[model samples]
Target: MDEVSYPSADVLKLTYVNVNPTNINGIERSGTLYSLIGDELKIANAVPGTRVFVYTVDGTLLTSSTTDTQGCSTLPIAGMSGSVYVVKTSSVTFKIRKL
Candidate 1:
């Protein structure tokens, strides 16, 4: 039989290093923004009448819509949870996370 010793608290503890965040997703920032309202994602600062696309992490197009004159568009993403998506416009693309 072999005997083993367990690691101490310090050895088993997790140490987090503060690392600078990066946008490494290859998505450029065109200053378009979005916010969540219930299950809908409301986009802001969009060019009015322009198109917006919602895609899954694998690049599947989930939905597409045009923004209203207020430079905003509300996308109904109800029932979509625990997924990361990419939202794009004619000028930019960025990643969004759903909780």
Candidate 2:
């Protein structure tokens, strides 16, 4: 048989690391690429006139729109509150939940 030994709690050392907290309230910020305001999905830094599509989680097409001159597209997500959907563009594809 083999015997095992364990370290005592009194001899243990703990290290603390600093962490930067982030905000996840769906607001547009420096690191946040997208934001959802009510039934409108806003994507930052997109190309102007880019085509955007919104689909259900099950791959059902809900709606589509094009970005304006400001590279922002206001998607009409009526009747999709509290539901998750997929948004896709020519350069990016991501999922967003309507609040």
Candidate 3:
């Protein structure tokens, strides 16, 4: 009998806002993801603390963090590549791909 092995990675939490020291929450819009390179994932937003999140197109949560006061957040993307990026919110979401 042969055993099947699947590659496993750690699951990370995704954040959409920075620590609301001023308020329990700030202006929220769910979140978005963008392709930084050819089939690559990176942070993309008009400003920091854009309440952005990075994740797998398959709806998998990767490294996540609330956008800094400037709406800047860090996403964990290693050994993963794709032309599509997924964005999600409490109600809606969309994808961003670069050609």
The residue ranges of model 2 lying beyond 4 angstroms of the native Cα positions read 1-33
Distance (Å) between predicted and true CA of 99, model 2? 3.9
**RMSD in Å for candidate 1, one decimal?**
6.6
| Candidate 3 lDDT, 22-60, residue by residue in tens | 564533554544445544445545355455555557877
Q: Estimate each model's TM-score.
A: 0.67, 0.60, 0.37
Task: Estimate the TM-score for candidate 3.
Answer: 0.37
User: Which lDDT value does model 1 have at 94?
Assistant: 74
lDDT of candidate 1 over 1-99, digit per residue (tens): 899566685465655586546836454665678787778988888789979889998989998889999888889988878989998888877788889
Cand. 1 TM to true fold: 0.67
Top model by TM-score, which number?
A: 1
lDDT of 1: 0.83
Residue-level lDDT of model 2, residues 1-99, one tens digit each, is: 899556776657665576445533443333325677776677666777889899989999999988788877677777888878888877666778767
| All candidates in order of TM-score, best leading | 1, 2, 3
Q: Give the winner by lDDT: 2 or 3.
A: 2
Q: In order, what lDDT does every prediction score?
A: 0.83, 0.74, 0.52
Clashes of 2: 0
Q: Which stretches of candidate 1 lie over 4 Å from their true place?
A: 1-31
